[model samples]
Target: MSDTRPWIYSTDHDDPDPRTPEPGHVYVQLVGGPLDGQLLDITGYTPEERAHGALLMSNHGLHGPGGRSDYEPRPGAPDRWAGAADTT
Candidate 1:
């Protein structure tokens, strides 16, 4: 998956909001495929994966306490990503 957009986190709601992700929360924008532009929460990734995911985000110029990035959507599986393993 590729990071091509800025990562943003919204801190307005009491509960976890897909529209507004907080620290430790990851929001990825899916690119290409049926789920393109869809925002996904990837907080369920393994610790190692999360670290790598953060690095990927950084490489794409997305930097912040929260893990967020614009990701290239995986083929076939809209909710699955090759870069970030879906443990859930």
Candidate 2:
């Protein structure tokens, strides 16, 4: 099977967001649950809002969505986040 992840074009190529010194966006690595290792781009959320984390719905009305995936800021690792899952 082939990898169908959506974060393939995230940080590698020339990023279009020019807000450098403090870009309007931030990438958090989701480290658990079904969305593990996924890079979530919280561009519109404030710093405090990002810290509170989010309960993202994978595929609400569709099949194989795996329900809501909860993620919070990983302690001591600001760049990474996670849901209720073992291992990092």
Candidate 3:
């Protein structure tokens, strides 16, 4: 059982969404057996952001950091909880 879903928890915005990977922020990669099959392609962020998640997708999303993004929360999605943990 591998965990491929990566995540990033930040305090900059109380409740940060894992789907929205920001640059310069810290995150964790779901590597290993327990999470090998749950992968979320987050190339929409930036190279640095994707690096934070450790997700290496094809060249279909953002490459580097050099743009302004207005990330809006998805409709009907539950509000992200705020807390601190091992964002590795």
Candidate 4:
């Protein structure tokens, strides 16, 4: 599967939600995969979107090009997120 979706690098300063984020960038570390230790730059994502994480494209890693690495947000750490074996 591919996580191919349209993305834009813009943050809304006038956003009404205050508990999530304030228009900035955040990085999440990938763990057990070809993209291990690779930090994905989610510059224009909200907290909800961040929590969902993503299946990143392994273009230049052990999996080689066109490979997808599944990653999820580690609970209890909002500002700082790390990868793990299981997030349940």
- Measured against the true structure, the TM-scores of the candidates, in listed sequence, are 0.32, 0.60, 0.23, 0.51
lDDT of 2 by residue, 1-88 (tens): 9545545213545666422324565777777666676677777778898888877655422234555666799889977887753221
Candidates sorted on TM-score, descending: 2, 4, 1, 3
lDDT (C-alpha) at residue 82 in model 1: 40
lDDT of 3 by residue, 1-88 (tens): 9534344422234554444556654333333322222223343566554333332322222333332212222234322111111211
Runs with alpha carbons beyond 4 Å of true place in candidate 1:
1-18, 47-88
Among residues 3 or more apart in sequence or in different chains, the pairs in candidate 4 whose N, CA or C atoms overlap within 3 Å are: none
Say which prediction, candidate 1 or candidate 3, comes out ahead on TM-score.
1
Judged by whole-model lDDT over C-alpha atoms, candidate 4 comes out at 0.53
Q: Against the unseen true structure, what C-alpha lDDT does each candidate score?
A: 0.43, 0.63, 0.32, 0.53
Pick by TM-score: 3 or 4, better one: 4
User: Highest lDDT: which candidate?
Assistant: 2
Q: What order do you get sorting by lDDT, best first?
A: 2, 4, 1, 3
Which scores better on lDDT, 1 or 2?
2
Candidate 3 residue spans exceeding 4 A from truth: 1-30, 54-88
Query: Which candidate, 2 or 3, has the higher TM-score?
Result: 2
Using lDDT as the yardstick, the better of models 3 and 4 is 4
